[model samples]
Target: MTITDAPPGTRPARRRTIGTVLLWLLLLPGLCWTVIRLGGWEGHSPLVPLLAFTPYVAVGAWVPALIGLLTRRRLPGVVALLTAVALAACVLPRALPDLDKGLSRGVALHVMTSNMLFGGADAATIVTLVRENDVAVLAVQEFSPGAERSLAEAGLGDLLPYSQLSPEWGATGSGLYSRYPLTGTGTRINQGGFHQAYGVIQPDGAAPVLVESAHPLAPAGLDLLAGWAGDMAAEPRADPAGTARILLGDFNSTLDLAPLRTLIASGYRDAADTVGRGLVGTWGPYDGDPIPPVTIDHVLADTRIGVQDVTVHNVPRSDHRAVIAGLILPMAS
Candidate 1:
């Protein structure tokens, strides 16, 4: 065969080589995620906070694969597609849902959680939300001392007769208020060194529910990462189903963080995720903040409890939106 009739394998071979290189490069994030899932990075990694929104990353990975697939590049396209699938697999279970939309068959208890932004939230708005929603229990983070007066003046005390207040100077305060009687209540300091209050609230005629207001240090830098991890690590590893526990507040971490995942793995589930509202943003929308919205606030509960409804609401003056859930507690056996 003359040179002109030579086999045409060279061009195809070169194309395959280029495709292989592209495939490997495109899959690097997949490798990083594998390390992250295995290493269990504490709240220290900036990537840690971003991990909470893995659905976005997963979607981003699929675009290149789609392009290659349309162009008939088999190997590169298959590899990219596989990588995209892996990325989605890591996050979709939480983002997507198979939640039971059926109404709860148990006793109803409305709970609400909000970070009052160092006492800057509108007292009337807070009180109105509580009264209007028929909130049985409320947890507030950043409960500045000024909040005590504002809340009291706004009729919060009358609306929710029982409370455990740990009023601090600035963003170092936390409190729990309820219509139910709170017993075995106590004071504790959270990861950010803020005072926190927790206790058992027994509804008028229902079984007692263990409620806690949690606020871990925000995962801002490496210096605070250890503390953030420790903060989440210190929580009791009890099954919510066995005792009926409700843990809600500004966790300062998201579902993507390893520490937060660890906390949730211990038998509690975010109320928002329970009904597939996990992707909704709970922070931002304040006029001056540079950070975009994110779902940093949460309401976590035991497995045995039935979630009737879960929602996010605006608190007029606060930066973080409030989360409210209607939970069905198991009747007294």
Candidate 2:
């Protein structure tokens, strides 16, 4: 054979090598995560709750993958990039904000919600967020007795003139404070058997809006997961006739949960999703993590409520960040 003669099995061997590389690229964790996320797998298992953040995990997988691909720049590398792009295309619509829906015309209100982290959140930090945002109403979960005392000592009574509080021993406690009078004050115990504080707030010259500080149980196990799902399902089927309903606090869930998704599908929209702030993490900087990872806290409003803006703020001495929303609710003439 000449010096340049092809090896006996070179062509088939090369084809097999390329095919194997492509298959491996397609089998990466990123691709698996994307498929699972797109499949909508929310169940009672602990992994299901963890799956709520799969989009972030999928997006994160790209860093090392792209670095390796760029360094290699072979067929496998190209396939990997295509895989990532395909995943992004498949999942982005949910993560991206739907701005096509215009704001509903009405009276505007600023609202904030926080989880006080077992009474550990500093009162001044919480109050500063309230004042800086000019928050008209504030809702909190895990509002323990000590937290209530600290809030009073820090001048929250003067800052927010009206209040409805249900302080339990652990994470069950919840509270709502409003600049406007909170009428029809009631405590709603959700399916998880935790008390949720709710009321109607009347803004001058506007129809009263129903507000609920919603804190479903954290799904740390199967029972809690079931409870969380049940708590979400038990919420009154949203009244979409523009009476204006707002539920804000630590849901212990993300939009990925089937129950939360169903809640939105029924009639409400998350303020952050409405405003185009995609997947801003409101949950953990936990276990030496640098930044918040998943968004479990939320401010959800009825479709009729116009969301002008939504933001999350860092609260000192707490694991959860606070969510603030600027909402315009329909006013009853």
Candidate 3:
């Protein structure tokens, strides 16, 4: 018989080889993703925006493992299992709460952050959340003059009277409102023209804390990625010896990105991650898109500050959720 008319036994061997080739093809992407993430090679243009989906990729990594095992390919199965475990190791910690002692002994300060989607978030709902949660400070991004008026009309002024507002006509606006008096208030406009409002608030029985409403430009395209990185890098680093600080709002980045992680490594801890709420998504689908949700908004507090709790809330007419953090500030010595 010719090669085209091979026997049935020979055909089985050919099928096995093809299956092995297919398994490798399926395994390549997951393997590359794990390596890039672990190696910190995701600092490039497209990878920066793409790595935001690592958590989902980590979940999908299991498919290769199962396929490898089902096909009885020992080497591929071993590699696939190891890749899944490695990816999980990188992702699973965000869900586990850290053992943070002495957090309950300090002065309590509750703060909330929200993005108004260019001034369209429900003002009343935001006010209700602030009132119900007893939020001491509120950081708003994409804040506009119309939003400022709507929030004031909704009685937000009655709740958080002290304010350092930079309400522009469009997406560049931002504001920081607090129940406590604000001092040294100003707005920092980043490279992409995104405004970040900041101030110092001294609560009763606590030392002064600097708070900033962070709204770095989104890396929507390759051209914006550098500006996004620059904005994140420009975020103030926490000094354990200096004034304690808190940054809350739409960071437009996830922890998976190297830039955000680098910023967090500078003496600040993610409040949600500290309390096991880090994996919870704060952005996506609120505007009725079919995209998967990701945790882009955050409450990053100084390492000296203690995180008590964190919760996310929904606001109408906005694509982002509001993140509230219960924090403990250091007492005045």
Candidate 4:
């Protein structure tokens, strides 16, 4: 009884030690990573990747703690469970876009659009990453003369098989590249006099997808962006089947902006939002200062297409990082 009774005090201290270690292991890395992400310094920005999916990290950290609680580990378990529920409640509503179940079937396509900063070396990096991801379609905003040639040489031309480049916004509009047969090659959506290219993209064995590649007019002047975004969101849905629609481009407005509200209201769910990667800032990697990043580049989808994953890739040469989304048709029979 002497040794056994005395041992009980040490057992609690040991359990506390183990609990503390688990908390640091499970929570510290993600929390520190979050801090670094939020603490941006110019081109050292990590907001794009963080915003695309940081909430999940917060949710993940609670798993170990929740395990501890269920196992009667006391304080750590309470901390973990509380944190997880709080994060889910805060993130799930705002981050997850309301999407239709039909989006989960049929065709699978991954598309990306980025403003390649015209003369930056990131153009090559963007093209390389896009090909590596095996994206079915590539929509490039700010496609300059020289950068376009570089992307072609980087094998975007050969791998994609079909391509369309717009001439109006030279070095700063939209272009489409596809591995499948592309048709309906014509001007479809125009915003604030900026003509972006749009067309029908037919991936192998899938129905034709309506691609609206745009580089909407930037919100630079006096309240012009509101009207510009309004026009973009109000564009009539012209596709016959409403088969699958992808509105990808550099919209120049954050999701919080009033102008973007119309786009969301018009049955267009942001891919990043649908996936619940909140508050990803895409436009501040090159400018050397700290600024809370905002989601400026977007991939908006109609309910007919399912979003598999939405991510922001790190390409250092450009001012804006790239946004990519993988799509699969949920109802494809």
Error of 3 at 326 (Å): 0.5
Candidate 3 stretches with Cα past 4 Å from truth are: 1-4
Report the alpha-carbon TM-score of model 2 versus the true structure.
0.85
lDDT of each: 0.79, 0.78, 0.91, 0.65
lDDT of 4 by residue, 1-333 (tens): 444475877877776676678765775564554444344211213232344344556568677666767667676667666656655554456566555433565778888887766545465687777778878888877666777677877777777878777743344555788887778877645546665777887666666667877666665544554545555565545343565677888777655344454565666667887776646678764555464556778887776677778888776767777888888743434
| Per-residue lDDT of candidate 1, residues 197-218 (tens digit) | 8999877556777899988877
- Model 3: per-residue Cα lDDT over 236-331, one tens digit each: 888878898999999989888878888889889899988988899888888898878999999999988889899999999999999999999989
Segments in model 4 whose C-alpha atoms lie over 4 Å from true places: 1-92, 96-102, 119-121, 167-171, 188-191, 226-243, 287-289, 330-333
Off by over 4 Å in 2: 1-22, 25-28, 60-86, 89-97, 101-104, 286-292
Q: What count of clashes does model 4 give?
A: 13
The candidate that achieves the highest lDDT relative to the unseen native structure: 3
Q: Please report the candidate that would top TM-score against the real structure.
A: 3
Can you give the TM-score per candidate against the true fold?
0.87, 0.85, 0.97, 0.66
lDDT of 1: 0.79
Q: Which of the two, 1 or 2, has more TM-score?
A: 1
Clashing pairs in 3: none
Model 2 gets an lDDT of: 0.78
Weakest 10 consecutive residues, lDDT, candidate 3? 97-106
